[model samples]
Target: MAFVNPEREEIKGLLEGNTTIAVVGLSDNPERTSHSVSQAMQQRGYRIIPVNPAAAGDILGEKSYPDLGSVPEPIGIVNVFRRSEFTPAIAREAVAIGAKILWLQLGVYSEEAAAIAQEGGLTVIMDRCIKVEDSILRPDIRRI
Candidate 1:
């Protein structure tokens, strides 16, 4: 069977309920899409945890971790900026860390990763941008 993303209502609920988001493959470069998107989410009041081995340091004023396993707090969402090929392992790690949502950013999608996350009891959103979704679903946040 083919995979389908959650409905808009469900997605809105996930965004409304979740707080801290672990952004996998986040880069320190402000020019990077991950950095911009994470910054937007942060402006909307979501805590962004940067996860990148090469750039494991302060990023956008938040502490960075080498990987999801190293994040010391409970992660509400695992927002991925990595390639599709890399997502399954990230999904598995997100599951291990007890993340509620597995969000693949715009232009990134992997059926294998979605399956892993779904089987692990996580809500999955693929080929979508969390920043964009929040702007659309929660207009009140956009005003801020």
Candidate 2:
């Protein structure tokens, strides 16, 4: 399957329009990338929903869920922090839960997962860091 980087307009629209981000694999430890990124997004006015089975009870002052389906609110984006091999399951769940976008964090890639997301008509971004992209592309906006 072919992968595409969303245009500036699309990314801008997503950044401006969507506020809730489901961070799958989010960790409680502040040192972790997931925590930092999620925290950054939260500071940027986005509602960060941390999804981790181990931390199902809490995270970032919000109740964490076991998975995307467990999240009660509408998810604008599903930002995955798991390895590439773990993405298809998350992608399926994200699509099933009606997420508008599936974002695999930097160093993550999954052709199958991306294909599944794209097939379900959800916008997919792989091997990219949302924080860096937002910071570089939208410099005026501080990420935390």
Candidate 3:
């Protein structure tokens, strides 16, 4: 199979198409990158489901899940904010949970994880910030 290259257009399309985003490693602290990114996505009318083991309760007015398996509904996107070494596990869980997309945040990359997600037929994006993409590509979408 050809490589899954997430180009600018594909990233824009994913940002526009997916409405629910599960932010893995999202922190409760507003200062954290995950929180800021989730906030931005939430503002863009995307439901931000915080997925963090350390944070099990409510965050940003939404309940946090321990992992992808704990999320009750089908997630349109799994935006990971974890390290590259930890991405394979997240990718496995995301695939098992049937997430349509696997998004590794800026500064994170893992070829193995990308392969796993792609092998499962899930869209894979790495080393890019979703918030930046949304803001730059589709500014029409205002966050709530």
| Per-residue C-alpha lDDT of model 3 across residues 1-144, encoded as one tens digit per residue | 544557888888887788899999999999999998888788778899999989968998999999899999989999999999999999999999999999999999898999999899899988889888889989887656
The list of candidate 2 runs beyond 4 A from truth reads 142-144
How many residue pairs in model 2 have overlapping backbones? 0
In terms of lDDT, which candidate is stronger, 1 or 2?
A: 1
Candidates' TM-scores?
Answer: 0.97, 0.93, 0.94
RMSD of 3: 1.7
Better of 2 and 3 by TM-score: 3
Write down the worst ten-residue block by lDDT for model 2: 135-144
TM-score, prediction 2: 0.93
Q: What Cα-based lDDT does every candidate model obtain?
A: 0.93, 0.88, 0.90
RMSD of each: 1.0, 1.5, 1.7
Instruction: Give one digit per residue, the lDDT tens place, for model 1 in 19-102.
Output: 899999999999999999998899889999999999956998999999999999999999999999999999999999999999
Give Cα distance to truth, residue 81, candidate 1, Å.
Answer: 0.2
Candidate with top lDDT is: 1
The number of clashing residue pairs in each candidate reads 0, 0, 3
Clashes of 1: 0
